[model samples]
Target: MAESQDELSYSLKREAEKKGFQPVGIARITKSKRIKLRTDALERWIEAGHHADMNWMKAPARIEAEKLLYGVKSVLVVGLNYFTIPENKKPNQLLIGRYAQGNDYHKVIEKRLKEIGKWLQTKRPDSKWKICVDSKPLLEKAWAEEAGLGWIGKNSNLINSKQGSWMVLGNLLSTEELIPDKPSESLCGKCQKCIEACPTKAIVEPFVIDSRKCIAYHNIENRNKDIPIEIQKAMGLWIAGCDICQEICPWNQQKIPISLDPDTQPKEWILDLTAKQAKEWDDKNWQKKLKGSSLKRIKPWMWRRNANYILKNNKFNSSK
Candidate 1:
């Protein structure tokens, strides 16, 4: 007997849970007025130079779903929780965001999405499909909200009631028509902790962020070694990515520390690195050190520059 759309959606959710994608939801594709408004807002933000050097945000991949996939009827939104609050900071240690501590999530999530796509193909052989991770320009958070995965929080992150904001999102677009889930509502209300917590004041408005002042943007996206004096000073000891906003969110407080997978924790040497080792660090050593890590996106010189900034800010000398 041919299974109903509800059955297929339930089956897909089961498989996604088996694959470790918690809070998965399916959304039907439609021409959205809200998306159009967001596109206009994005254009204005770009014009205001809020995007910094990431001009790719204006690319076709950022276009609407109907444009990205013809006859696209459904979007499978999946959330993977990568939230692990670090233990107390040790003396002279650099801070790396939890998201970048593991194998490149782009690789990990996309691999799983592909597996789900294959499963869908087996069930509906005639259906066309498209898979997207952070690498793709799709506005995944909006889709996630539409799919009832979570609400877009004041920190400009998708926040699930159960998972909080410590999530990485991936999407699967398919030609098959499936039942759509109800959209999650805005739960931010009057809370403004994330806004006040930012050292660089990157969150300009309730749900908007100016990347020019974002620590993560400067550390990861800024190709130039010469970061602005104010941003550098505000950067503190973050050598890779920043997590201040997410850390300050009330929702994230509920996150219990999960087991630390070997691949997901910073290398031992990284935690105990001294000024002497940092000064002697070179490109060859940097490549070998971050071989499987996502930090490789930034070149060796950038890493050195960030480390030097931190060392200089803290006035760390070679001794001890």
Candidate 2:
């Protein structure tokens, strides 16, 4: 590459790696046809009421990316592997989602993204930039695919060939032109394992999920005083975000365990929590243990609700 071309984004990948971001790529902004497909899909999803109570999905801000960052020339899409296989030897352990097993990813990702943004700003003194960690309305997975990080799996999670689907995505949009990498190919060939394995049949179709039937949505986003009986029964032992689809996917089976961060480990307390103890935990205790953890997003009452529901089923006390 020519010197002028190399200066387009000032070695964005190298700068991101310095801050411990991997699976990073730069993509030029344009009226991409792929983005149109994603927006159209979102419209259909919202119209079908699949978004459930997540009214934010219907907002215009989330419907378009150009409006979010007008005159945007490039997007620096990055992924951090947070996949850690748990050692749940006991049968009584409550199952919590792998993503929330550690500190809040929003905080971790944003901090790293800001550092990259600062470096890019120095390189392009006159350009504007924005750092996003799923906080904005932008289509993060779509951009990640366009940037060559990964392809959107049939289960709707981004699937990287090397890192699998166990990744947290973050982005840096800038008004500076940069060389864009070729988009990744669709690697999920005729795989229906994720769609077939869902307990609530949340994966209604390939690449589509109905939040109305999704346990993760009910447990995390649904603020209703009581969970619907059908959904609750289908929840089984999932006390937090559900990871059935990801776990079933063959892509996630092969993991570079030593490469991922150790902070992603689940707390010992979570592994040993029981329905009776979870119900007795006070507000002060809840805050103290889950102070910086993503699991704290669910209130103590909600925690008890999930635990009790699992206990009622007596299905299996298996924790993923």
Clashes of 2: 0
lDDT of 1 by residue, 25-93 (tens): 988877576556567767887888888889888776676776677889999999877755466666777
lDDT of candidate 1 at residue 33, scale 0 to 100? 66
**Candidate 2 residue lDDT tens string, 1-320:** 33354665557788887766778988777768887888899999999999999987776856556677878888899987777665755666667787787778888888888888887776677878888788677788998999999999998999998888888889888887888988887899998999999999899999999999999998888888888899888886678889999999998888544335656666778777666666667878878878878787798788877777777776643232
Model 1 RMSD in Å is 2.0
Alpha carbon deviation, residue 299, candidate 2 (Å) = 1.8
The global Cα lDDT (0 to 1) of model 2 is: 0.81
Q: Against the unseen true structure, what C-alpha lDDT does each candidate score?
A: 0.81, 0.81
Superposed on all Cα atoms, the candidates' RMSDs to the truth, in angstroms, are: 2.0, 2.7
Instruction: Name the TM-score of candidate 1.
Output: 0.93
